[model samples]
Each structure stands twice: as structure tokens, then as C-alpha cells.
Target: MNDRSRDVRSIRLPRWGRVAADQGVVPWLVFDEEGKAVEPVRRFLIDFVARDNRVGSVRSYAFDLLRWWRWLRVVEVEWNRATSAEVRDFVLWLSGAVKPRSAPRTVSAATAGTINSITKKPYLDDRYKPRTIRHSNAVLRSFYDFWIELGGGPLVNPVPLARSDHRRPHAHHNPLEPYRAEGRLRYNPKVPRRRPRQMPDERWNELFAALRSNRDRAILALAVSNGARASELLGVRGVDLDWGDQLVRVVRKGTLAEQWLPASPEAFVWIRLYQEEGPPLDPTAPLWWTLRRRDHGAGLAYQPMNYEALRAVFRRANLLLGTNWSMHDLRHTAALRMARDEGLSLRDVQTILGHAHLSTTADIYLVEEESQVIRRVQDHLAELKKRAQLPPPPVALGYQASDLEVLFGGDQA
Candidate 1:
């Protein structure tokens, strides 16, 4: 046993390998040390794809499973032999382990996780966030559940639920009632609820003014006006625009359903200018195009603006404005303005935002801003002080101070 342990320690461990879509049978697959696909994992991924899961989801799950496989190799345990203790240890390791970064952090340790005065964004560090850990826990449980159901892997799921009782969760809850979450993973890290941060109008104007082109201005204007997600907006085609109705068709992010949302007149005006900036467009071509071009052995050709290109546009704007605003910030700004400033109903906001549930919209935008709440509370206290300074309500319709002093004891008065 000691010699075997030494052998395991001496041998360099193999890292995960990726198979591109062009080279693989499926869209993508992860290979083990011998350059062979882990059969069960491949099967699970095939089933995942069969269920109509997105390519992004497949990639994410593949990496997560690869991590699990690496952990199993280190512990000298077969994948099917893993128990709850293994899952617990895996989660604990993730919590304490420093995630490997491609490059060293630019910010100092002291500044890491602290909000920047200029950008108002936290300087992130090389640690796994609670959300990432939670996602890993979920992926493992699902993977194990798939194998266990087929009577191939462990008898019971290794990633056990936090709930002691194994009865059906929320079995008796009303369908229309707000969902009360239950049965999270035993070792899952708790994620804090973060309120959406909206960019103030002043900062929005600064960001707007910093944009160099009409295309960027139009994208920002449309986003802030309609709350379309960056990817969704980028996916918009020239034919999706309705000039007569002033509505733009966008594919909903979660459901992938198409929806038309109203845009501001100012946004439409910018869109017109942006369209005129380029030559006549094909109706089938993408709505947004890049200014710069890359030679593809033919000539410099402009490409459709993708999410990364859109991000770079904002990255330049952020440097100019010295604010760490994101594309999602525009969505939040539009949602908040529609919900609070425009006094729209939660249902209306949900429809426009393409949220599946009305409660989701209400939960995010219905809450009062912390600063606004504090200001209102301060005003209430000032009003109380003003009331206290009033001259005893005009002496109570002619009752004198002396009479009041006589009515009660002089010391009490």
C-alpha cells in the first residue's frame, strides 16, 4: 500500500482534454488521460444534447464533470464508488482552493473585492464564487442521479440534499403562490441576494457621450430604452425592426421565444443615423456591424457585431468615463425606470423584460433603493424636528402656557 501510494504521488496527473465539434462525434467531448472519452460522461452529454440543452450548457457541464473526474483520480476512487463523503470533500476543497488564473491579478490583495471609487465595481479575486460552487454542486447531483437511475453507478446519490426528510419537496404548496425554495445541497455555499444596480441618468449620459460612433450610440439607446439583453440585441436581424410601430423583435434569452418590444423615439432616430452610416443592408444580414474589419485572405470585410465586440465598445467607453458599467446595467436602468419612474404595472414590466414570471420582475425592481430609503428616513426625522419646534399648536386655540402649567404640576410642565 505504501509503495502504491508513492507510485501515485510520483506519476504526473493528467489534466482534462477537449474535443472540438469538427473532430468529435458530438458537438464537444472531454477526454481522459488515455485520450478516450469517459463512456458514462459521453452518454450523459449525449442525453443532455438530446434534451435540447444549449451548446453553452454542454460546455459548462463538460468542464464540471472533468473537474469531478480529476478529483476522483486524486482520491484513487472509481467514479461509480463515490459516496456522499466524497461529494462533501469535493465541495470543501473547492471552497478553500484558489482557482487557477491564466494571468496574475492586476489589482492588489487589499483592493480585491473592494468596490472601486471610479467604477463602483468590486475588484474581483481568484477565488470561486458561491454561485460557481453552487452550480458545481447542482451539476454533480444531476450527473449522479442520471447514473443511479440506470442502476449502474452508486445506489444512492452522493450529493445528498440538505433536507433531512426525503419526502417530496414543496408537495403541498399552491401553484400560484411564490415559490419557497427547499432541499439545496448539503455542502452548497450560501449565495447572498444582490440587488440590481441601476446607472444614474448623469452617468448614462457620460457613457453615451463617450461613444465614438452612431452604431454604438444606437445600440446603447435601444438597450436602455427596451431592456434587451446584449446577446439578444446582437442577434437582431435587419428584418426584425418595425419602423412603422417603432418596435424591435428580440429573441428572449431564457425561453428563446420571439417578442417585440417598444423603443424610444430618440433610439429610433439614432438607429436611422446608424443605418445611414453604412451602405444599404440586406434584410437577412445582422442589424449591428463592426466598424473595423479583418482580412480573411480576400479583403478587409466588416463582420456582424457579436457579444464580444459589443463588450469591447463598452470597455472603451468605460475607460473614457472611468466607470465599470456593463451592458446588463442598461437593462437594469430601463427596467427600473419603467417600473418606478414610468409607474408601469409589474405584469407590464414582466412582459417587456421577457421574464417568465411576474414575481421575478417584482422581486428585483419593487424594492426601494437603499440610498433613497435613507434619504426618506432622514426627511421624516427632520419633519418630526420641525413639528417639535412648533409653538404648541398655536397654544391649543387660546389655552395659555400658564394655564397648562397650572393644569399639570409646574415640574411636569
Candidate 2:
């Protein structure tokens, strides 16, 4: 048999159940007093996810555990008695082995380093970027957290393990820091930097024109007009719209807010046309559905479209417009237009955009036009000229002869 098969067969799971990792089959394993693999970790993981109200989270955790189990079997670690250190090592192995299929150009060096570090002590390399190390550490941390929570081992957070910066004897030293002086390393928390929000108006019009389908146009229009987030738009149902009031009930994050927005008559006409000709409509069904694909067999699915789909749409829009524009920029355009053209207050713009803070709304969505600035400068210059042209102030009232002589140069005036 092959090495993989040999490894799989050697695993001694308890009578409770054994999960078939090879086939994605999770079996319940029950262990006795003498540490033996009994049931599959899948049952426990599934139950845990269900209990935590995260059914979607189980598949990912299960996938991670399966790889961990395979490594443990190969390394001859007693699954029941696996120490925190062993769990840590297993996690490092998993992170490196999982290849990202999407971006083929990039290789996961951090993952490889993590695997090598756990398996062999002398494999440390100084060239690993801080960001890469942090990501590998996070994957390990998550795996250990799951392992501990399942009653398989003692509760130990692996974050500390991955985060610890201990130098190996043979490892190359960083130029910035000496090996002897390397201090306790704490993982830096990741922070997302905000990008400039608004795009040029010409690009916006071009994108709008490029949208081929009525549904696509309507989605973009509503998102731009109402300044709604992708999630809010995805969650929208047919019933959320009230034609009489010209309002839509939007759920932002978790809070529901009613927004008053007037749709153009043409836009309203398109929306009605979409309802009649678009995906089959149930009152409770998602307002947006996948554009029917022949390969997928043509019926509307209840779940709303994903973020990737929205991104693909935006990418297409950008290609057509000959400019890059993100979905958030649409909302920004709406806010800026309201502030500049509609003569709305900052607070009013904030309300329209559904921003939690007025400052954040202003900082991102408000655009300062060069023309407006130039106009203000010109007005200031005109005022100054008018003031300069006025007659000189009556020689300050009390004119003595000597003062008058000094003012008029040679003699008294």
C-alpha cells in the first residue's frame, strides 16, 4: 500500500466511531479509559457548531481537523494524549500544505515555514514577513481552540505558541536585531486602512450605462441612490419596497432602518419590468437572484447572491468604464452628489448614507471640487478690490499743520 494508505490504516480510533477523512465521511468515535480513538471528530464539531448557532462554520473546522488527524497518525502521536505542543505542530503543518487555488502566481512561503518549524527545529528562516507569520499563527490558533473545545485535550490557546518568538541555534539572525537580544514577540493585530471613497462622475455614468440587464441596472441604481451596503441590498425582498411612500426598509448589519428615497420614473418602470421578466418572485424570496445559467439548471435559488458576484459585476463595470470603481464608491458618489448638488447638510448626508458617525461620512463621501474653491477665491478677490476702490478715510479727522505737511510731502495742504 501507499504511504498515505499505510498512515490511514495505522490510526487506532476508539469504538465510539472513526471518521473517514479520505472520503469526507465523519464517523463518531467513542474512546474507553485506555486512550483509544472511538468516534469521529466530525460529529462533535458539527454538534458544537450547531450549538453555537454556526452551521456554516463546521465545514471549515472539520476540514482543518481532518488534515490534523492525518498528520497525527503519520507522526505516531497518541490522538487522545496529544499535548498542546503536538497540536501546535499539527496546525503549522496544515497551514503550509493547504494551497490557495485562486491566486496561482503567489506561493505561501509563510505556510511552508510554519510546517517546517513545527516538524523540524532547525528549519527556521529569517526572511519570513511579519504579515505571513501572523496569518500562519492565526490558522494554528484556530485549530487548537477547536481541538480543546471538543474535549479531546486540555484547554490551551495555541495563539501563544504561534506568537512566541524563540530563535533556533542555527537560524540566520535578522540584521535589525541580534539573536541574543530577541525579546518576547507579541502578534500584531491586523488593521484595514480606509481607501479614498469617491470616483469621478464621468466614470459613474459610464458604469451605469454599461449594465446590460434591467435587474443589474436596478440593483446598481438602488445601491447608488440609497447608499446601501451589499448585504443590505442582498437582504432586500420585494415586500421591502413601498411604492406609495417611495421608501425601502433596509437592514444595516443587524439594525433595521427605513430610508426615504425617490426613484426616477424610468427606474421604477425598469424595476416593474424586472419583476415581471426576472427570476420567479416569492414575497419572502430574495429580490436578487443569479442570472439564470444553463449549466446550473434554471430555477431561482432562495439564497441571495454572494460578495464575489457583486465584485465580478463591479469589475465588469470598471472594464467598460475604463476606470476602476469599487461598490463603496457608488455610495460615496451618492453622498457627494447630495452634499454638492442637492445642497444637503453634513448631518443630512450622514442620515441618507446611514453612517453611524457624521465625521466618517464627511471624511470619505464629501468631495471638494476645484471649481468651487476657485469661485470662492475669485469672490474674495472681488470684495478686496471693491474695498480698495472706496475713497480714503477723511485724513483721520484731526489734521495738524505739521502732520498735514508730513502727509502732503513739502508743505501744509
Candidate 3:
């Protein structure tokens, strides 16, 4: 038999799974513990790519399907035989189980789920967040939907919608009203809403002092001033900068539309310094380049800065400051400052932040700080105490105290 046919015959559903990305036409594929490609999963992923979904999305779905396949192996259920019970059990397992650590732990387990003092954010532990479980449910539901339509897998979708009645989902829902939770997928975990944590000015200064180079400084300045996403900032090219206008052009995420955003004068100054110190730049070259070089076949050459490189810069600063700050934190800091400190309107902030909807910007940046609320509450309590300690007011100027008391009652108190 041919190699392709021979490989297919040797494939079997394994207890543990692996996700692999091919350098060929296929973006991603799943394999069993025995290193045999799961034909069903391969086909599904290929179809997903053909539908114009992102390659990153394909990778995410492949991992989710791999997890589902592993769970199926444990229960000795074939893919087509999986029921709602299997999906429910999978979510339950994810809820309680600690995620496997890819490397040795550096932080103590006691610190898990606690608020970090420096960053003012929660310390993440080795467990799947509720959002991840919900996403997995969605991936599984979509996967089964694709198969059922082709008449290859189970007749009905195993991952069913969370329905309140037998009626169709969203059958009579009002367009203006918020979507009800009953319309969501069954077995999906409820993800709690987390407010974005902005860095305090003092902590921001400390982080700035820890940066190793002017390139990182310029990056931080631009990010904190423009509220651009990390990826969008990294995508900037040398030609995209306008020194006269003090603006930088970035391609917006999701929309891919180019937008020119205003940046601080200090950011442009730092950019000039960084560019002066670094290698000579071509107008078409990437604005941000790595300091170090790696051999790319011919010889050692500097590469354009990517998300990972930008993250590493912050990682080093975080290490020095004893904080866990991400690149996105700068965007939060900028948005909060614009909305709260600078007295900018929500619409203005939304435009700068590149949010598709005004409500998104308002919901994230318009939240009252807990500390500010506590201070106001304390002041109110103090005022109430002062009023309570004051003596009774004197009788009206026109009437005697005894006469007023007799008119109302012996004791008006």
C-alpha cells in the first residue's frame, strides 16, 4: 500500500494526544499517543482553515479537540458516540483539576490566586480559568456541528445549548436587549468579569527605571501614550512615523485598518535616541529591531521585534521591580488616564483605544477605583458622626422655647 494509505491504517485513538503543525498546506493537525494522525481531526482543522479562520484559531481548536479526544479515550467512548454527559464531565474535570505545568515552578503555591502587591493584579495559578473552559465548550460544539452536517458523526450535537425550554434558542429575543445566558452552550463555565488593572504613577516610574534600553523605553512611552495593543505597536514600520506631526501609524487588530495615533513628544525623542544608537535603518525596515542577532542561514542578522521580544523586555523589567506586569498593562494605564485623569470623553477614548463599540471602552475604563470609593465613604461617615455629635438647634428667633414646646408637645424630641 502507499505510505498515505498505510499510515491511515495504522492510526488508532490514543489515550493521550499531541497537537502538531505541518509546514505544508495544513496549518495544524492532532495525533494520538502512538504518533498516528487522527484523520477526523485533521480533516476538521483543514476545513476550518479553508473557511478563512485564522491559523492561530486553528491551533487553539486543535488543542481543544485533542483534549476532547483524550477524555474520550479515558471513558472508552468513540468520537461519534459522545453524549452531553461526556461534555459535562469534561467541564467538571477542568474545573477542579490543576493544569499541568510545562516547566518547574518558581513562585510559591501559597501565592496562587492572591492579589499581587506591586501590580495590583491576581496571581495566576496552574489551573484553567473559567474562560478557557467556556472556550473549550464552544470549540467542541462547533466541531460536532461541522461533523453532523456532513452526515459522518453523531446525528445530534452532543454539546447542546443551555436551554430553559424546548423552544428554539433566541427564538423571541429582543434585538436591543442583552442576550440571555440560557442561550449559551451547556456545560460552559461562567467567567467572572475582571476589571483592567492600571499601574500607579509611582510603580510606572519604577518600571521605567528598570528598562535596559531606549528602544524599550520608546516602546513603553508610545504604548502608554497611544493605548495601542502590543501586536499593533510591534507592527509599526519606520515609514509609518511622522516626526513633524508626532504621530505613529498602526494597523488596528481584527479590522486591519491603518490608523494614525498621536504620541507624546517624549516618545518621539526616545525613538530618535534609539534609532541613533542602533544600526542604520531603511525606510521600509521595521521600526523596532532586536539588539541581538541570530544566524538566519547566511550570517548573523537582527530581526524585527515581535510580541515575544516585547514581552521579554517587560519580563526583565518585572523581574527587577518584583512585579508581574504585561505589555497590555500600559494600554490600560493610558486608557484610565485619558478617561479619569485627563477628563476625556468616552467617545474620544474609544476612538484612541480602537474599540469597535463605545460601551466596551466605557465598561472597562469608567469603573470607579475601589480606593477612591473607600475614601469618599470614609468622608461621608465622618460627616455623619460630626452631625450626630452636635447639640439640638435653638428655638426659632420669633418664639420662646417653652411656648414652642407647648404648641407642638411637651417634648418635641
Candidate 4:
């Protein structure tokens, strides 16, 4: 056993190989000696997120796994050796310490609820909202699956750690449902205050004035005119623009729909300016680049600006304008202006917003005609009153008051 241990240690076997040997199995699979199972998992996540163009989600998952990795290190357990019980304990630790410690500004109940829901294990308290726990569950499941595929150790699936009924009725307590009632397993619907829509002309002027760099200006123009999501905007490339037709192609996430948006004249101008001044304007170069800073000096390869950079610009602009708004709110502002002021149909708004469903566009851009319902009810009441005012048909000759009383009640008598 001592000689065998020395041989195993001296071979400089890969991480997965070590895991397999520890599990009493001979290692045959070839893998990187230095690169562990998590390394491939990271690469896979990077490619998967990039292909899906979900930069925010990718970053979030990366951080989540990083936290898990840190916890594993603190516990002195090799990641490959982690069992379901250890995972559960870690989740509990995260629910009590990590989440509360990390989000101190949140309400106590809300924070507790968040921790419970995010972990999704009923063994832990289920009071919080479920988004973070659900996300963590997905990340961990994927990580373990990848580890197993790489021959790390005995395959242990963690998804069944939480019991959830998939086919429960809407009234049943289910956390996944969006419109769940209070005291149910899901979060209560938030009643958002309706802010008056921004005037298009004012927004346009402010956007132009706030954005000085060609790239920033172009981003604002594209977002306003095309009503593209941040991810869609980030995915745009130089070749996607058709200057002649004033069109820009975007790869919409979820469906991977390639959509060509009609670029307004203003959009065309800004796009042209960005093409000239930003990045190299190569066909494959990103449409937006970070503004060069004097401290960074010249000739350094300019990094492409991501979605967060675009959001920062919007945040700064909102601060200057004294508005509690975001870049997404700008899209809403554009949709509202187009639907209400430009006299655009819901379908037109749908096209502008790249909505796969027209109903979603309608909900966002079309205001309910409040008076229409009242008018209909009023018209119905008026018709009833008119009928009531009509004289009774010349009562059949010799119809007695007693007969009328029998038909119309004591008042007629």
C-alpha cells in the first residue's frame, strides 16, 4: 500500500485521475495534469454563455461557483470528493452566513427569504424568494455533471436534493409561478407605479448631449431607435450594419433571432461616426469600444465595451436628468412615444422592440382605454332607462287595474 501510494503520488496524474484512484479505480482517461474538472467547466460555461450571448448570467454563475469553491477550500474537502450531505451543509452555511453577510442592506425578511429561495432546498428555510437558490442549484448541478463526465469520482446527482411538484395546480404552493398569492410558495406580485412617459424630443436631446464619444453616442442612438436589449446591442458587429438602407442586424437572445432593424437617420449618422472613430471598424470588430483614457496612453488595444458599460452611461445620464431610470426604461420610453405620439400600431411597436409575441408589445406600449369600459356600461344603462320611459302598449281594451297589479305589482293597482 505504501509503494502503491508512492507510485500514484510520483506519477503526477491529472486531478480527475487522482479522484478516480482515490475512489479505488484505475485512471485511464487522458486529461490535463494541471487543469482540473472545474477548468473545463469554466471553459464550457464561457462558450455556452457567449454563444447564448448571456453575458450577465454567465458572470453571475461564475461568481456563484467561485463562492462555492472558496467554501470547499475552507472545509478542507477536495471538490471532487464532495457528497450530497456536504453540499447541503454548504447550502445551509450560505443561507445563514454568506447571503446575510453579503446583502446587509436588504430587509431582514426579504434577505432571509432570498437566501431560502435561492438555495431551493426545503431542508433549509424556504421563506425567501427562489431566484438565487434556483440559480445556484443549476450551477452546482452542471458542475457535478461535468465532473462526473470527466471521470472525477462516483456520480452523484444533486437535483433531487429539493422536492418540488412539477405539475401542481396554480393555487398550490409553488415557488416557480410568477403570479402566486401571498403566503404561498411564490413571491407576491409587485404593483409597480406608473411613471409618466418621457417626451421623445426631450429624451433625444438629452441622450445626444450626454454621449460625447462616437461609440457611446452610437449605442444610445441604436438603443433608442431600435429599442434593442443590452445583450442584442453588445452582439452587434460592424458587418451587421447596412449603411445604404440604414439598417442594423441584431441577434436577439432566447430565440437567436436575427433581426434587421430600420435605422433612423439619426441612428445612421451616429453609427457612421462610430465606425470611423471607434475600434478598427473591421467586419468582425465589436461595434462599441471603451473610450481611451489619458492615463492608459495610446496604441493599447482598446477593449470592446460590454452591456455594463452601456448601462453605466444610462445611469450617469439619469443622474444628470434627475430621473430614476435605466437603459431598459429608455426602451420603454421609446416604445411609449412611438405608440402614443408617433401613432404607431402595436404591431409596429412589436417590430421595433423585437418582441416574439405581439401581446408582450401591447402590454408594454399600449395604454388601456380606461373610458371605453365606462362608456359601454353607461350606454347600456341609458338604453335600459329609455326602455323604462316607454309608455306601456295601449293596454288591451278593458284590461283591469287588478290585472295590471298582477303583472306589474301593487304600485300599478
Candidate 5:
């Protein structure tokens, strides 16, 4: 058997298991319940993604691949031999353009497809959004490229990738002329950019006020003040904090680079309290502990907090405050406060965020506040009037009766 085939056979996949590296990068990949890896493609992920990407990211890719696999089975196309048309159909299926084939044997009023779990068939739905389609496209493209690079699949990749900002590829010769997609597989639609969801000061205070526990309060405060993503906050360990310097070391997602950022005084206070009141700390234990208790041979043991637990804490606060804000909103709020309100430079914000590229920081988190943007425009207009040599108007003005009448409507004026 080939290396790819061998790799697939060697994997012992569990319903909920993470592939971790010996030391670095906590979760390389996680296998989900929805997807099962078969021969070549399963092997492809083992070598390509599982050992390289984060656990959460691997889980996403697994789901993406699962969709592709199910589509292949439904359409009766072999993975290596799939044509560009078939790939397009898959994309369309994911975009909710076309529904997947369902079993006539089963009946459900909600006409969407439901799969026979025993048979591993998809009872498909046209519920996919653009982002879902784009992500699936990327995963397949990556998988196919890895396969071809290993000198396995067809010489030419079936999935054609197209230009994003502009249509068509930058290549001189386009072999896919008749197919008309060039060498590209995806035609990404322009997603309209919107301002980041930032928690207003009043709303933030209210959300915090609604929380009764110090643990939840600290968790939210740390996530916001540190500009930490959900994963980063959960992954922090007790040793990661430097009490003397008031810095907490975090593993930046995707890159796994270690960065030490300042913690908020309020966060520090609460963290200290939580650590003190929390279960007896092992030096190597995770900083955050879940309230979940299990029998630990002799006594009850509290497990380290994870992504789902952290989310549950936020969910309760959200329900209490009657707000729909998310964890990332706190990160955005922090970025907004730092760059717009606190007058921190873009570079400073970028460092605090631990973004590999300053452009990503500038593009997403550095969005100017609406009120700030209005003030800027007003200030610019006033500056332009001054520069044009317009005299400043007197503070006190005598307005004519006609002026008042025109300003308001006649009788009201």
C-alpha cells in the first residue's frame, strides 16, 4: 500500500479525540462524530492537517471533508476522478443552491434530506451560507493539492480556484479555457464588510453587574482586557501568568507563538481571588478550572476549563442581560477601546492582539468607532474651512425674524 493508504489505516479515530504533537501546539487535529475517514482522503488528512493545525481547526476541516465525502457518495463520483462540474455541484449543494438526494424510504414533513446513520448517507439540507461554502472549498482545495503534490491523484486538479478581488487567474496560459473556470475551484462572492460588534461601556458594565460569581467575571474581564480569543483564554495555564510583571503568556492561534501581554488590574484581582478560592492548585494545572466534579479515586476532581464551558458562562450572562453579544465581541470592544478611545497606535494594538500580519489587525479590529468617525469628519470640515481663510463666527449672534421662521416651520419658528 502507498504511504497515504498506510496513513489512513494506521489512524485510530475516536468520536471526540484530539491529535496532539509531542510538545508544541496542543491540539493538532480533532476527529468529530459526523465524519469518518475512508482510505486515501482520510490518510491525506493524517499527513497534511492533523499534525499541523490546531484541534479546533482540525475539527472544522473534518466537518468540511465530511461534507465532500458525503457529496461524493451521493453523486457516485470517485474522489480522485471527480470532474470540475461535479466539484461545482458540491459547491452549489453547500451553498443551498441544490439539495442532496434523500431516501424515499423514510418520511419527514420537513423535506430536507436526512441520512441513514447505519449506511452513512446524507439527508441533505440547503441550509449552507456563503461562508460555509467558502470554507468547504478551501478544505477540498487544500486536500486535493496535498494529494497531487504527493504524486497520487490526476495530473491536473479538478477544483478550479478563481481570483477573489478580480475575476480570473494571473496565469499566462489557462488550460481550463473550455471549462472556463481557469485552474481555480472557488468563485468567492464579495461579502460586505461590517463594523466589529463592540460592547458599549454601559452594556459591558451591565453584563458584568449581572454576573454574581468572581470566576465568570474574571474570565470575561481577562478575555476582554487581554484581547484574547476564546481558545487562547481557555488554553492559559497557571504558570503562564507572571504576577510580578502582571503579564500573562498566551499561545496565539494558528501560529502557536508565545506572547506576554499586560493583564487588567481588575482581571488580576479576580484571577488571584479565583485561584485562592478555587480547588487546590497543582503547579502544572490549567489556570481556569471548570466547576465540573468527578470522582478522582479518593476525592472529587475538577477538570480544567475548555471552550464549551467558557461559552456556557457567557451564555448565562447574555441571557441575564438580554443581549446577544459573543465572546469575540469583547475582544473587538477591547481593540476599539485601545485604538479609538485610549488613543493607542495601530502598531500597539497589533502587538497587543498578537496578529502575525499588521494588515489583519488594521482590517478587522482597527475599525473606527461610528461616533469617532463622525467627529473626525466634522473636525476635518472645520479644519478645511479654517485653511480656506474663513473667519470664525462670533459666539453671540442676532438672528432676523425671517431666519428663525425659515429655521423652524413658520408658526413653530
Candidate 6:
């Protein structure tokens, strides 16, 4: 056991790998199904952090690369020599297709890797959702690019057809993605960009009205008013708020950095009320829950309210709301309200939302072009007309078609 452990330990590791070993982080500990640490996988993940990628991004990339590893096996191609055609087929598979027969959806072991990871239910389904396809393609393309850069057998990236990139992200000020003179990679798949979901005004009003607890009201108000994520709002410590400046410093989720988001006047009032009713002030202490009586009196002691606690609040409030909403809808609601109602510019919205790129901000909060609006209206009207012209559906029978003859003994006809 010691010799085996020594062999695993002898593998040269980067800084992130050492950190993963010490911390036992799951995402950073990816290995093949056979429990062998592939050197390429190890180096790629380490490089992900070397490029200063966020923890969440590294985790996602790890999973995507795992799928790619499985794909290599199914294609009967070594990882070093995969061609562009296989990459294209992988992307197409992710976009899903109707089956030809009572044909089992399992096309290949590689595809099954993706399908099983994505939903796992629908046991044999080979279909990939458009969103899933897009995400998978991105990760795979990036992995291939990295492999080529590492001089891993192939000189060409094999992720073909770069010309279809209409995602002409305007030269924006993201430091991580500098203007590549040769241009960045893009896959040409048409996935519908769905609008961000927001709570309707009526539902929003009903939800707030249902909140009888000061803490619940304050928690939700901060989320909506500031466009802060649930974790950001939940992570608030007393020191993070500057009441005089009407700003709350949140350690933004995913991107671990503090950002001062402006708070509504009502937010300040409710938060203060909740704070007063709960524990006494300690700047370093989490502003949310108080320590239980047994755990009290410890310096800066706290028990920050968890996701389930906040979820329970929403679940109770749901009884009064005609519709349901998650905590994230608050962020979306704020984003839309800022851009559409308050006339905030894209750059300003980006700043408020802590988005890394202006293109990301633009994608979410797009104003339809006149032609697009007209086309949408036409489609909607056509749908209405189609519904109006439809014949009523046939009434359902309590018995099956064969049961009708069997139960009634109706050869009498």
C-alpha cells in the first residue's frame, strides 16, 4: 500500500494539485474509471488554475474533460489522434435527435458518458439538450486546444469550422480574454438564447406581501434590490455593510471577490430591523442567524442560515403566491428591472451584476431589433390562429381499443 501510494505521490504536480491533495477537493481530484490518474488530465486541470480560472470554472472543465476521456475510448481513437469529425459528431450528439426505431438511444459509450452525467434517468436515452450540447462543445473545444498547446501528439486542434462564429463579442475589457489577433474558437450550433426568467410584478408583490418574518423579508429584499446572488446575500457579515454609503459589500458567488452593490432604502431599514431583533453586533460575525444558546458567548459566534432554511421561507411564502420562484429569479428580476425599467446602460448593468464580460451582459439583456420583434409578433399571432382553428381533441376512453370489444363482447356489429 505504501509503494502504491508512493507511485501516485511521485507524479509531478502543480500548485493546484498540491492544494487539492491537502484540501481533498473533489473536482481537482478527477481520475479515470480504472482509478489511474492520467497525466494529461492532471496537467490540463492544473493548467486551468495556472491560467487563473475560478474554482467553479475548473470544476465544470473537470467534468467536461471526463466526458471527453470516455469519448476517446468509444471512438476507438487514442486521445492524441482524435480528428475533427469525431468532435463534430460529439457536438451533434449533444444536440439530440429523434430515434429511428424502438432503437435504444445508446449510440456509443462516449455519448452514454455525457447522457449519464447529465440526467442518468431515461436510462438508455442518447439525446442531449441544446444547452447541454453547447456547453459540452465549448468544454471539449477548450480541452482540445489545451492538448494541442501542450504538444500532446497532435499539432492541429481538430475542433474544426471556426468561421461560423457569429458571436462577434465586441472588443470588451475582460483581462482574461484579451483580443486574440487570430480570434477565439467558436462552434456554429444554433441554440436558442432563452430570456432570463424573472418573477412577474404581480407575483413579486404577492411574495413580498406573504413574507411576515423580518429576516425573510430582509433576505429577499437584498437579493432583488441589489441583484446579489443568494450566497452573496447569505454571506453578508456586519462589517460588509456601510449604511452611510448605502452599499453592501458582497463576496460574489463563483467569482470570489467582494463587490459593493447599492442597496434600496427599504433594504437598509429591514436589515437593521432584523439585526436588532437578532444577535448583538459583531463586525466579523455573519449578519444572518444567531448562535444557538449552547453555542453563544464565543467571540464572533454565528450559525449562518443555510440554503434549506432560506428555501423553507420561500416554500412557506409559496402558499400565498399564485406562482413559484427560486432565489435566483430575484437576481434576474433586478437585472431586467435595472436595464428595462431604470434605463441602466449595458456597462452599468455589467458593473452592477459583477459580470466578467460586456458580451455576457449584452446576451442576457438584449433589446429585440425591429425585424425580430415583427417576426416574433407574427409567430405569436400564427400560434393563436392555429389554436383557434384546432378541432377539439377526441374524448379519452376509460378502456383500451381492444378492451372495448373484450368488455362489451361486441361482435354483434
Q: Candidate 3 has which clashing residue pairs, if any?
A: none
- The digit string of per-residue lDDT tens for model 5 on 311-390 reads 77766875565455568878988887777756678889889888878898889866666656788999999999887675
| Residue-level error in angstroms, candidate 5, position 316 | 1.2
Cα error, candidate 4, residue 191 (Å): 13
The superposed Cα distance between candidate 3 and the true structure at residue 258, in angstroms, equals 2.3
TM-score (C-alpha) between model 3 and the true structure: 0.83
For model 2, residues 1-413, the per-residue Cα lDDT tens digits are: 01222323334322222233232333223232344533445455545545553322444444445445655566676555555555444434433333323344233333334432211212223343445445544544554556676676545443453234454422686778754623322343344444344445565677888887887787778877767777777777888877776666677553455555554455566678778887678877778777764344656344466778888887686555544466776776666677775667888877767778988877775656544577899999999999977765445457776787687784543
How does each model score on TM-score? 0.83, 0.50, 0.83, 0.52, 0.70, 0.62
Give the per-residue lDDT of model 3 (tens digit) for 1-413.
01111122233334477888888566888987678889888888878888877777889999999988877876677999888777776777787766666576765466777887867788788788999999999899889978987999987788888776777655788999996656688787777887876788898899999999999999999999989999899889999999999999998886889999999999999999999998779988889999988788979998888888988897788767778888888998899888986667889899999999999998888998766778899999999999988876777667787777889775533
Candidate 6 Cα errors over 4 Å, as ranges: 1-27, 97-128, 164-188, 196-198, 210-213, 252-257, 277-282, 285-324, 340-350, 355-413
**Candidate 1 lDDT, tens digit per residue, 337-367?**
8888666777888899999888899989998
| Top-lDDT structure, candidate number | 3
lDDT of each: 0.81, 0.57, 0.83, 0.59, 0.67, 0.67
lDDT of 2 at 43: 52
Off by over 4 Å in 1: 1-15, 18-25, 33-35, 107-111, 118-121, 166-182, 296-299, 341-343, 381-413
Question: Model 6: which residue pairs collide?
Answer: none
lDDT of 4 by residue, 123-222 (tens): 2233323456556766776667666666774455433333265443344655775753222222112234343344446556765687657777777777
Indicate whether candidate 2 or candidate 5 has the larger lDDT.
Answer: 5
Cα RMSD for candidates in order: 5.4, 14.8, 7.3, 13.8, 11.5, 14.8
The order of the candidates by lDDT, greatest first, is 3, 1, 5, 6, 4, 2
**What is the model-wide C-alpha lDDT for candidate 3?**
0.83
